[model samples]
Target: MKHLADLLLLGDPRLYQSCEPVLESELPLVPDWVADLHNVMEEIRAMYQFGRGIAAPQLGIMKRLIYLNVDRPQVIINPELTAVSDEQDELWDDCMSFPNLLVRVRRHRSLTLRFRDELWRPQTWDVTDWGLSELIQHEYDHLNGVLCTMRAVDAQSFRWRPTPTH
Candidate 1:
């Protein structure tokens, strides 16, 4: 199999649409997706140097899925973020899916998402803070043909990318 980055992440209209349904009956084992996902994570890790979490859909997987974990970096999550605080916060965000651009996004301050573990057992988690929340929301948006820049919610407000600071 090719490296995950070899997979395209942009200019695909699918990345801009709702992800395909993920059947709960066949949730993948952690070993199944994690290794590939980890490779993708490592490939883009530098883009997220000060950031946390990334998702496959942003890499253009049209599945009801994502991977998320904060600064801890010990895990790769899928079908992530089932329960998010109805309460959301707005914050500035950068994305591996969208490099060099910073956009303001709205997300729950906390969440409880469900997914299978490495062995494929159903599980849930509570998450808070900007990284996890923002990442989940960002990736989730990809599932809906949406991008973080869309958070600006105005075509005019969207910028191609940011001017990097030295």
Candidate 2:
């Protein structure tokens, strides 16, 4: 029963490594992991005042799964970015794995993604909102072994932007 306390911290080697797809046989674990993600995300959001999404790898589970709380709790499994606009925008992105830091990064302004829902149903999302677009990209990076730190424009692009409570 992995909990909020078991998050793979910033320096954890696993956080820098790629993740494997969630196998059909492993689908049973999805609910538990999703629960953990939601629980931890809630805590982080309340503590920091922001945090709309999280990835499975953040919890040390190398699976292609991500959770988002846009209008509702959304579970994206085996997500694939089908299309990305050439247009981009810069934002100071933050992550649960490294809560104290913010990385200046550029992300697409719109995207089309294909993924499976919590019930294993195929779904497609055409995101146009810059905020959701960037959020998806951030979580997608985690699925592919990339982090905001790696996406930082430069060394100076990374900075300490700890939450007020911190």
Candidate 3:
């Protein structure tokens, strides 16, 4: 099982490489991968108190897979974004890869997410909520070797996350 310590950090070269699509023949391995992802995500949540989604590459899986647990657990495979709105919103986005930093970036206010479920069934979701939309976009960027730091609005858009008071 993968742990928080296995997570790829911000400066890892693998994090800058684009991921490959998960093949149909690889479906059998997805369960274990998702389990590891869930474990690491849970650890991130426990340590940093914020994490809604994580990509496979974050754990060095190097596949177009994302595990998201907002209202519930969701396994997204080879996701594609469509119907992205021209409207945008700026927010301080954080990542498990660099938990102590946040990047100010602009994201689409709404989008349509198309992907395969764990059963290899096609699924579509219209994400209109700003929070969910941004979360999905952030994860999708990972599959393309794009980091939140790359999307920063400006050089001054990066900030350290506030340390909690004991």
Q: Please name the candidate that would achieve the greatest TM-score relative to the true structure.
A: 3
Model 3: residue 114 alpha-carbon error in angstroms: 1.0
lDDT of 3 by residue, 38-94 (tens): 999999888888999999999999999999999999999999997899999999999
lDDT of 1 by residue, 62-117 (tens): 56656555545444335555677778777766666566566766777887767655
Question: What lDDT does each candidate get?
Answer: 0.60, 0.90, 0.96
Q: List the residue pairs that clash in candidate 3.
A: none
User: Count of backbone clashes for each model?
Assistant: 6, 0, 0
Model 3 scores a TM of 0.98
Ranking by TM-score: 3, 2, 1
lDDT of 1 at 117: 52
How many Å off is the CA of 72 in candidate 1?
4.8
Poorly placed runs, candidate 2 (over 4 Å): none
TM-score each candidate. 0.70, 0.94, 0.98
* Candidate 1 residue-wise lDDT at 94: 69
